[model samples]
Target chain A: MIEVRHLVKKYGNHTAVSDLSFDIDGGQVYGFLGPNGAGKSTTMNIITGCLAATSGEVRIGGYDIFEQPEKAKKLVGYLPEHPPLYLDMTAEEYLKFVAEAKGVKRSDMKRQIEYVIEVTRLQEMYKRQTKFLSKGYRQRVGVAQALLGEPELIILDEPTVGLDPRQIIEIRDLIKQLGKTHTVVLSSHILSEIRSVCTSAIIIAKGKMIANDTLENLENIYSGDSYVTLRVKASEIEIRRALAPMDAVMGVECTQLQDGVTEAKIDIDSDFRDKVPEQLFYAFASIDRPILHLAEEHATLEDVFLELTSQADISEESADDTEAKDGETV
Target chain B: MTAIFKRELSSYFKGFTGYVYIAFVLFFIGTYSATLNVRGTYPSFEYAIGNMSFIYIIVIPILTMRVFADEKRQKTDQLLYALPVSMGQVVVGKMLAVAVVMVVPAIVSCIYPPILGKFGSVNYASAYGSIIAFFFMGVALASIGVFLSTLTDSQAMSAGMCFLVLLVNYFQTTLVGFLPTSALASFLAITVVILILAVIVWYMTKNLLAAAIFAVVIGGANFIYYSVRPVKYGGLFPDIIGKLSMFSRFDTFIESAFDLTAILYYLTVTALFMFFTVQSLEKRRWS
Candidate 1:
């Protein structure tokens, strides 16, 4: 377990992280979701002891990070935004050196190194110098280094960046596998990546955590009213008149459709599907109109993410970002 | 500590810096030995060591510049910081590694006195004494270089700044004579020195109030001392500066005095700078 209480990191006049606190339990993968410069890396650095916190304490497996750093650090492994690697040394040699520095026993060292190499699939590149390796392989070596000593907690910062789609899937699978045995905490700006891998997520905008919950719970929390999309072989006025008469219906509006069939969206509270669909069916039948399509449009995770993160003063710098995400969510 | 020490030592030989540093030091040693001991027919190797002591001002920077600076520039210090080792252990390990690199060539230099004994009578005791003193003196100088390397991440800048400091320490005795040693002049000099120290303290702690209090206290104490005993300040500043010269202290061992005070001074410098190196590293994490 890792507990970060009121963590803060400041650089001169700029605040990197402010009054952030969260607890991470074991055996689950947690995602840190934020845009660029959102203090994800800073918080990870502080938790892993790479950077000192301005105020507050981090306890890893009940060991205070500042007071008993070696004990606390022994329980955690960290990979920063850039893999801290020695280009001059081969991957095998670097892993051995790190294993020794991490206080792995000489007897277990060989076995530990082999395990990480196999897990990261670096068996082919073990003898090659890190400088000659591709960026993806270098990142794998970085992950391999963190896996050494078998720390209880592994923290990765943007682990899938700069990788091809196939490599990204491979790493995502690896992270999911690691989560079954060890707690995994990863940060990325990719929403789908988090949705695919993370059991829970914490989303931050401008250094403040805006949401922290499961994807399903977050979708429900932001979803205020239910809307349904219905397609009927009827005129727009006919469909609107049928939906507007239902007692549970708040309003109805006709939206564009590709087929000759007309489409209208119905807004209502609770699950009025049973009564409303029957009422609409009878009303439309009496008017001799055929129903082609009827389905409830459930809110997606992207909708909740946009509605929450876009409320702050997004600058001209991020206007394009908003537009791009808006297109996908809509 | 052992892991870091082994890595540092291996890195020295992995690059040309270690071999070049040893070759440069030995080259100067060979030239100085021929001129002072062989051609001059001096029985004591101490004379040769004394004449060649200035070589450290150049070689020490080359040997120690990349020790911490390269780690920082490459961002490998993050690995060190994240490791389960204390900052003190890392500093001590690197210092010991550099000491090994320096002592290796000095060991080869150790065989010179016995070989010279074949041609003529040689003072073996004094030769060994000076060799030991030379080793400690170089260690002390290298510690200063290591501390300077911790202050910046640019290797060239670290080397340049370390070389400048060594130059000042080498010529401090001569430079001291140029300073006026009158009561008022000594008072002003001490005040300026104390204020500079306070500023450095402030830079380290970033506590302006504490630094201001310390400066006032030191300035007030010095002023009271000068007012009470005006004549005692005469020639004191120059005498103090001469005492602080790192190489000047080694002169006693070369003269065959076996001065334990100089040896103590060298050890003190080594300890003080090692402590400062640790502090510099710790401060980097906080800031």
Candidate 2:
């Protein structure tokens, strides 16, 4: 549904988004995982036709964003990082204007505004000036604006950044619901949020895309050590000696516990859980060792995120410097 | 375009900017009307508009300062850029919205001429013609403001720059009078103008060769012309500056001759500034 090719955005001598390219299919939520200023927002801006790329081509729904902007933009609903809003106006008034701007028919405009308001859950605050709304409500209103016209692709830039934990979960659930119908692309630095919500993930660093693949595939690629933690009523040396002869065990590290139960973290060549308990039973029976705790601890999506982002050595100094500058000014 | 126009119009009324603009215009009209029209018993309100034209140097900045510049500062320009709308549409839509703010008060002022007509013979034709001219003049100046606002994201900076530009334009007639009208002086001035134009071109495109070539060609052509017809350069600078002043042209209309040249000049100013505004917006994508 969206194709970004060799995109580069530069501000004077500073490059914002480097030669980045990616394609997003329909229906699944795609997470643009990047540290702040990893060109996540810039790429999102370029794709949504919000900011011009220094050099590149972006096509949406078969329409070139620059050459045929209006047609292409019709397919995109963009919520910028700051949530571009008119604070003085009421939420209803704001949504009405956006609906009109999106070319929603006059007959459907009222209903569409109402529908979006309901979707973003801004109905109660519909008449309240956006200035009076809390940060979370303001963000919901921003989301409501994007939800108008029912665009095919929804691109949100750091949508849940300033929200509280509850609001973040609400926005995440909303994004997941949005993914069911539209191609949703959202950028966030929070690894857990992306893993929980997005089907596919794109990890970017220093304006360069480091990784882009399905969540499962990414975890699979990073998923190497199928280690099982085993606690037994035996000494560290005895526990290691017992597992040392097991051919299925790749490596074993045993540590003495406070209650005289030795804990062993056993690395296996593969998933050897089924036969391990039985083998351990007989083996420990021979040694008169009692098993206390034997459980597998699988690697999570956070592990994958940490692994990928860390591998791409990129400086995130600019984003910090910019924020500092903005803070000083504000 | 309609969406932008409506929001802009609504914004004007929502904030005090639009009301402040109208009040500012009315305040000027009231003071000028009292001094020139009411007390002095001047038949032509056009004369009042001619004198009161300086009000734009303040009001145009207020009306247009936030138009594009504030959007950028707030990052709302992203919303504008992402929307299913062209930059031209956004520019023209915004220009029209400001135009409406300008025209509203002028329309209210329009009613004054007829009311004065009830008491005394208001030269209805020239008065209305000059008012029309004044409306177009405001539009032309506002378009210039829009173009300047696009140059920066800071509203204060935009307002300051716009005010400065307007200040130059306001004194254009007087400023032109200070220029040397000698052929040699005019020829030198044209070279300075060409050099400045070349620098501006280079700043925009960063194409040093093209800018140098353009500077040389224009300078050489003017140099040859001055050598060929030295007399032609005499009084040429004043005439050129005189023609360029949007104010000087308005004077011809306010003084009661329906100067088609003045009308055309206003239209041309509007078009030129509007074109520059579009270019400024387009440059954002490239830069």
Candidate 3:
């Protein structure tokens, strides 16, 4: 539903977003994952036509945002970094104003607003002025604003920011529900939020697209290697000897547990990740060293996110003094 | 555009700004009408509007200072930019809302001449003509105030700068008297004005090359023209500077027959400033 190509946004001497490109199809929750100042908000703003990119093109539902902003924006519902609420206006009044601005027909305005208010579950707070709302309610109002006009694409920039834990969970669940009918693109630094709610993710760092894939695929691909821990009925030297002939085993460390039982941690080549345990069982059986207990470990999304962002940070700061980082670490 | 207009209009009325502005205009105009038209037995109602035009300099800043400034301060302009509406729509919508607020006093002032005619004769043609001119003049001032609001996010700063600019515009005719009328003096004065214009362009765009080019083109043209026609420079610079004054044009309507030129001038000023407002907003997204 959205296509961004070679987008760049520069704020004078500082480059906020640079060379970022990604495509999002409809009917799924796509996580826009990035660390702070990673240009997530900038990219979202450009996509929603809130800001102009330095150079590049953004298309929404086959419409160029710059050339046909009115038609293009009609297909989008955007909740920016801060909820654009009039402090003096009641939530109902603000929603009505938004409904009218989005050109929702007068006949459908009430019904459309009611539907969004129901979807965002803002039934009770509709009459209250926005300034009186708590942070979570304010965010819900922002989300409700985006949900108006039945726009097929919803771009939310850090929707769960400044919300409490329970509110975050509610918003994530709300996003999951929204994903059933519309293409929901939400940017957040919270990995668990993306993992629990999003079907796919686009991870970016330093204004560049770094990774984009399904959650399962990303975990499997970037998890790198699988390590097997086993308790074997043999001496350490005997167990090591038995595993030494296997080409799949990259490295092995063995320790004597009790009497004749030995514990061994075997790092397997990623190419053999699938059959390492089964092959090891047969190999140990051939040497009469029975494999008693075994388990494999895989990396989590947190590890992947940290690894990607920190790597980008290092490369981004390479032109600066690396020695300066030492003091920060200290 | 209608959505924005309604919201802006409702905001003005919901808060005290609209009421306060109306009260200020009516209070001063009321005092002037009582003193000049009632007690002094003056036949012309336009004289009262003419004498009290200074209220616009103060009330305009209050009315328009928050129109765009508060949108920026609260970051609601993001909603405007993201909405299906164009920047032109937003600018025109808010301008029209301010015009509507300005119309309140104009409509109230209309009752004066009719009431004055009850006691004696009144020229309804010129009297009503002045009211129309007064409304357009308020709209023109409001447009300038709205444009000034786009320059900053702080309401206080917007109000301050608008007040300062309009205050200077109000006194520009009198201020012209203090300027030197000699050929060399006009030449140097115009050069300084061009330099200031270049500085403003630099501040807005932050492009030294663009500003430098503008300075050279305008300043160089001024030097060339002044050196070529030194004999024609007598008192010309002050008159040119006085041309920037908006309030003085309203005096033409009060002094003689209905001045269509003054109305056109007000409209042109309104259009010019509104265009600047739209461009300023578009520039913000790029820079």
DockQ of 2: 0.61
Candidate 1 residue B93 Cα shift, in angstroms, is: 1.0
Give candidate 2 misplaced runs (Cα > 4 Å). A241-247, A271-295, A314-330
DockQ by candidate, in order: 0.66, 0.61, 0.73
Q: What is the descending lDDT order? A: 3, 1, 2
Among all windows of ten consecutive residues in candidate 3 chain B, which has the lowest summed lDDT? B248-257
Q: Flag regions of model 1 displaced more than 4 Å.
A: A225-297, A312-330
Over the stretch B1-287, how does candidate 2's per-residue lDDT look in tens digits?
Answer: 99899999999999899999999998888789778888898767788888998888998998999888888887788788888888888888898899999998888888778867766778888888888888898999888889989999999999999899888887888888888889889888888999999999998889999999999999899999999999999989878877787777788877787787777788888889888888888788676
Which candidate gets the maximum lDDT versus the true structure?
Answer: 3
Give the alpha carbon lDDT tens digit for every residue of A1-330 in model 3.
888899989998788888888889888899999988888988998898888889999999999999998999999999998999999899999999999999999999989999999999999999999999998999999999998898999888998888899998898889889989999999999898899989999999988888999998998888887788999889888887888888888898888888789898988887787888888888888887777899886678888898888888887788466668876799
Q: List TM-scores of chain B, every candidate.
A: 0.95, 0.94, 0.92
| Clash count (model 3, backbone only) | 0
Instruction: Report candidate 1's interface RMSD in Å.
Output: 0.8
Best by TM-score: 2
Chain A TM per candidate, in order of listing: 0.82, 0.86, 0.81
Candidate 3 on B1-287: residue-level lDDT in tens? 99999999999988999999999999998999999999999989989989998988889899999999999999999999999999999999999999999999899989999999999889888888989998998999889889989989999999899899989998999999998899888888889989999999998888999999999999998888888998777888898989878888888778747988888989999999999999989987776
